[model samples]
Target: MRQLAQSGKFRRDSTLLEAAIEETNTEIQERLKKDRIDFDFDPYFAIVRRTLKALAKEMIELGVELGKSRKSNRIGERQKFVSEAQTPFEVIELGLRNAIEGLVALPLAKECVLDLERIKQDYSVEGEWCPFRVSTGNLKFIVDDDGTISISLRNPSETVVKEAKEVLIALASQVYVGN
Candidate 1:
């Protein structure tokens, strides 16, 4: 009878134990919510975002510099032919031929090869001009009489082509004209 009374006194009530467990769970959940809120508003994330923006800007600036250098080299090559030409026809013919050949020999980023035989210069009587058309894989480059170059890519539909062309133009403009 004495042992039974002592055990009863020492025994924990189930209700009290349950209440304590529930209170601890609630506190833990609240702490987790607060931690989530702190993480969402962290200044480190803002710093990272700003750093990425700055890096992108710097990359664009570098691309522009590279494009300008390439343009200058092309201009120099054309100038060399122009200086040696006795007539305007020779200037146009020789310059276009040289430029197209140079482009054909240029190594692309990938292991892609451009067929030199496919490069052609067409003279238009209406415009009194000659433009070179160069084809490589699905891409075509048309060099106009006024030296303006345009790119065309093959697609199944006109709408798709237009949409894809915009993206290609954006990327090409970055590497080519840097605009």
Candidate 2:
């Protein structure tokens, strides 16, 4: 929990530095050595990346265990293999659900969600690379200025990719048409 809190702080600091670098051409070395920042930018990101990687491995292992147990429970019945189940995706979906639920429960978010259906999808052009081909519930999109597009739907069970693709197309089209 402490490391997670520190990681969050690092992320926020990195975001600020990123903006400053863009706006004023700040030196990366200066950012690294600056005592003003709570966390060293490079080391902070390294820690976060390592932690996330470990977490993914642990989640995968837990999924395998659950799958084994589930299969064992069906011993004499119809041999349904839980090993083929959507374990990892299910785990990720649970986390996403919790976060979204929390957001919805917040007074500010609840009040701001008046146009629930019209909520705009936020897009980012830069971030860490995604390892999975598709997600189960959350949505990720990348649309470049040159009309190139890529999307990964966190929820493969739903139409997340299709919806994000449509939005990306609309956004790209608007940009192209000088809207």
Candidate 3:
């Protein structure tokens, strides 16, 4: 964390570094260092793991197959090593502050959300790469984006639904206390 912060990407804007200003690099360094030491993975990540397991179990019960999309893009590992942030600290500082609406980058993310729909697929997972494609659409969409956007209220073909139900049953059966 110290090495990443000292790399200088977290420096406040130069325009703000004016004469007579109370700001100092020493303060920034200390704060970053402090946050790094205080930053607990549990406050941001452990709960998330629990939540995913529960949700995945639920989805399986609901018979959501989350059929394969394209392929694994290794999003988790890549994001853990963002281009500007070779280290995790840089990514956190640059993206997430104290609370994220969120990584609370990328809600302690590369977070895979189940949109419960098939559309607008964005990121690709790394650690637990999914054979199924998904978007953090998280059921949230930009209401005011450019383009001819249209929403169709519908469901998949009967056969697809049947297959999904079958798969859901299979998965739900496999689900265990640790799952």
lDDT at residue 74 of model 3 (Cα atoms) = 16
TM-scores, all models, native as reference: 0.18, 0.21, 0.18
Candidate 1's C-alpha lDDT? 0.34
Order the numbered candidates by TM-score, best leading.
Answer: 2, 3, 1
Top model by TM-score, which number? 2
* Candidate 3 Cα errors over 4 Å, as ranges: 1-38, 60-148, 153-179
Clashing pairs in 1: none
Task: Name the Cα RMSD for model 3.
Answer: 21.2
User: In model 3, what lDDT does residue 172 have?
Assistant: 19
lDDT of each candidate versus the true structure: 0.34, 0.33, 0.26
Residue 24's C-alpha lDDT in candidate 3? 38
Residues 1-179, model 2: lDDT tens digits: 22222222223433433443333324555565576654435656555655555454444455455455445652111111122211111011112321211100111111111211122333332433322122213544443333233453343443543354345444333222211
lDDT of 2: 0.33
Which parts of model 2 have CA positions greater than 4 angstroms off?
A: 1-138
